[model samples]
Target chain A: MKFMNNVYQVITVAKKEYIDALKNRVFIIFVSFLLILTFVSIIVSSFDFQAKVISYQTALAELQASHQIIQNLTAPEFYPLQLLRGTIEYIEIIGAILAIVLGYLSIAKEKGNNTLQLLFTRPISKIKLFFGKFLGNVLLLTSVSGFMFFGIYLIISLIGKTVITNIEIEKIFLSFIFSIIYLSTFFSISALLALIFKSLSNSLILSFVIWIVFVLVIPQIGDTLDPDNQVPGGLFNKIGITQKSDQLTILKDFSSYEKARDSLEQSSFTKHYERLIFALLGIKDMYNGKTINFIINDKNSDILWLVSAMILSSTLTSIIFTKKKLINK
Target chain B: MNKIFYIAKEEIKILFREKIFFTLLGVFVVMSLISSFLGFMATNTTTSIYNSSVKFLIQKGINNIPPNPMLSFGALTDFRNIIIYMFLIGALLAVVIGHRSFIRERKSGVLPILFSRPISSNTLFFGKALGIGITIFSIILSAFLIGILSSLLLPYRHLLFDDILRLIIFYIFSFFYLLFFGFVGLLFAIKTKSESLALFIPICIWVGISFVLPEIISGQNPTALLNPIAMGQVQVQNSVFFSLMQTYLQPFSIGGQYTSFALQLINNTSQTSLINVILNNLSNITTLFISIIGTSTLCIYSINKNNIGKDEIYE
Candidate 1:
């Protein structure tokens, strides 16, 4: 009875947030920008792949006309989902910023307009209101991810003239859910910061600083510090350790460095989200032909980290909004 | 000019007093302290691994081995990560500084009072712009001194006079590069009607400049920029669209120009003479000048057009 009333109050608040964001000009312009970038990046990649095959065919025909052997020729190979690389990165960087903007605006507007006091006088608890905002944003990000994935599928099919497999669809769906969780973590963090700070602009700038650290700086440090990235192709490939046995033999000597790099990457939810999504999309070669379950099993730790971070952040935001005297702060 | 100097000095003081600005300055200082060390650490780890591989090969009775290639690389080249750090964090910090320059005045209701003085809008605008320029220069100088200290303090590596000259040149260009973003922040701050939008628009523009344009030119995804070994720029580097993008947009790619400019001289990745490196970055110098002049022109024009009666704006 009372629980249902509380749920109703949360839903009402969430509905208002959704409508507010939907009407925002900044959000609209940014979503359009990301979609356009996705379209351009994927088309370029598709045509680049097609050009390779066309050139191969042209060479094969010339060889036949000149009475030359074509026995050793081979066509370029690639997975279709690999073209989603740009889309993934767009979501990681721009999408995260959009979430921050949403979160900042969420609390900033209430405080700016002095609606926080009015809302507090209402029949809703602060925790329910916080959860309501979280749910509203989670729904919005999910819709964006769904729209983006659908756009990617249409682009690949219409442009590349290929069919997406059922397994591929499942991978996209799983990636979609994790993408929401990743975005929601950022959303909650920014919301908490906006609630904590007295000045909205400073809090907004601080949220951006946190975004830069988690999204760009930490992951980049981990990548640059990687010993394998020292060479052009890779250290392992350059030094004749292509064989799995030999590679394992060599890696035994660098376990400490590798562990340090892994632990550093583990600290960033962006990296975990990236790892999980890239595996699901078959962007990494080792997982290209692997089953969805196998990829899920292999990337279980990243999956857990992303989910846990999202839940923890949301819980923390709720607790702070409830326990602290932050509403009027 | 004296009034301009006075106003510029005040603007700098106001920026230094901001807590958020101080926080980012601390991050920039810490990164600068570790920039050269991280570069050296990467080289050390790579060389150590290569040596181990060589020993393994020799034990297996292999005939020949390759020498350590990283040893031949220049000392300044190890500072590549620092260049990227400036591009990311330094640019954002500059934007915040610029946004605050005008927005702070507007929030505090000082535009009318300032206009009532003998100072013209041009004087005030130039004063603020000069203030931003000096602030960026001071930050870069601190990083420069830190670079020198790191180079001197490290034992395994040494920087020659030429290496120091290259660092100086790179930091000089970096100052202009960061100032352009500051100008962007100023332009939008002066023009935009909303407070959050003022900060928001400049960041979007920064993303387009630093990430999207280069991605379009290279036809490589942003992921490749992060971890290169996973997916490289091999396939699209040969496309017609890639060629066209290079000829047209690559010259004006603000971030790309800065990156290649630094990489050519400091990283020595191009293996060219210093004069050749400068000639290669001719586009960088021209476009950076154009960006600075154009943005300042708009900022100056916008300042004159500012609504004097408007004290505060929508969020």
Candidate 2:
């Protein structure tokens, strides 16, 4: 009976939190932006594919007219999965910010309104209350990610005119699962910060600073450290250093710098999440058309890092909220 | 005029008292130094590699080693990252400054008192603008000084007077570019009802200007997305949309324009006066000027029309 009651209380709180999140204008705006951006990315990728197809068809037509050998004129392979590349980038940037905002609003609103005291006066324990809020947000994030995945699926199947195989659907599902985990880590961090700081604005500002550092600054630092990352298509590739081993050989000359860059990149959960998703969704050119088994096997460490980050951040948030004082005044 | 100065002085004082302000300022300074330093390191590495390759080629009896690209005026391209940083973090800092200058005052109910002091809204607006101008100027000046000091650490190259002059010119352009963003923030702060939304609107604008438009303009050309230097190397058969982006969108992209102008100045490719460069890119210059003036006018107009005492009077 007690266990059932606890579950019921958690559900009740979760529902309240979900309703509150829906009413938030900022959250609404962010969700709209995410959806719009995702849609736009799909459209843009389709246009890009169309342009390539037209050029390929034109070349093929000219070759046939000129009586050239048609053996070398292979048709362009349509990798509809490549459209997810832009979606992933948009998710990386916008999804993370949305998580932060949702996390902030979840606790900061209660604290600002002194409703935490009222909640503490309830029969439920603080641990349960915290879990309820977390559960609520998890459901909300899942819904958001699910909506995005469905949108992507519709665009790919309807617009790209591609057959959605079971394997492709599985990959999309797995990517959404990973996105939820990746975004939950940020949500946990933001919630923890909100709980720690008395002032809502301070917490929000600190969260943004941390977000900027992790999301923008760290990856940029790593890119800057490697001369190859400064240029598009890899600087070495531009200069005829096409082989991966040759690139590594050149990079080995700057081992100390590489070590620093690697360390900085490892410190950011954003990098780990990006690495895993890029591999899983075939966002990177090298990863395109790779099987799920190949991605999992090759990117095992990235998967480990992402899961670890999500666990660590969520655990920290739970502990902090349960132990910390509820009232500021 | 004296009243405006007093208001400006008070605004500056309030800005310095906030911990967030100092933290942001520190971030800007440190990031500027680090970006400039990394740029120097990247150039030095390239130069060393070039020298060693040339030596090996000469030893192999191939005497006609091509001139090292890193040793030319293009070495100044290293500082392009600083301009990029100005567009990203520098714009956010401006938003913060602009928010604190106007939005915070309105939120704290201090604006009515200030308005009651017999000062016209135009004078007050100018004062706030002047205060923000001074604060941003100081930040940029420090960045310039630190940039110069850090550049001296690059072992392979010596600073030329021409390089220094170009750097100064770039910093001047950066100041105006950042000021325009600040005014944009102020415009939103005055226009929006919610304070958080006010701040968020500016960030949305930043992302749109800095990322989205450029991505659309540089479709399929990955290099042109981030680095303006790579835009020069892109060879595309222009479609109608592409042509439209180049002609219309390119002029309004203040960040791209500033970056391109800075790159030209630092590379010394034109060897012409800054005025000539401005004339050459008249459309871009006009767009930038119009943006600055339009935003300032809107900000002043918003402040003048709105009742400063009412909290519910914003959009």
Docking class of 1: medium
Instruction: For each candidate, report its DockQ versus the true two-chain complex.
Output: 0.55, 0.31
**Can you write out model 1's per-residue Cα lDDT over B86-160, one digit (the tens) per residue?**
988999999998999988888788888888889888998889999999999999999999999998888767888
Q: List model 2 lDDT by residue over A117-197, tens digit each.
A: 787788989888888899999899999999999999998898777898888898898899999999998899899988887
Clash-forming residue pairs, model 1: none
Candidate 2 local lDDT, B230-258, one digit each (tens):
54344442355555666667766676666
Give me the displacement of residue B303 in model 1, in angstroms. Answer: 0.8
iRMS of each prediction? 2.6, 4.1
For this target, which candidate reaches the highest DockQ against the unseen true structure?
A: 1
Which residue segments of model 2 deviate by more than 4 Å?
Answer: A52-77, A229-251, B48-68, B220-224, B227-237, B245-248, B267-276, B312-315
Residue-by-residue lDDT tens digits, candidate 1, A206-310: 999999989998898898888878776777777676777876677788889889888988899999999998899988878887899999999999999998998
TM-score of chain B of 1: 0.95
Provide a comma-separated list of chain B TM-scores, one per candidate. Answer: 0.95, 0.88
- The residue-level lDDT of candidate 2 at A84 comes to 72
Tell me the deviation in Å of residue A25 in model 1.
Answer: 1.9
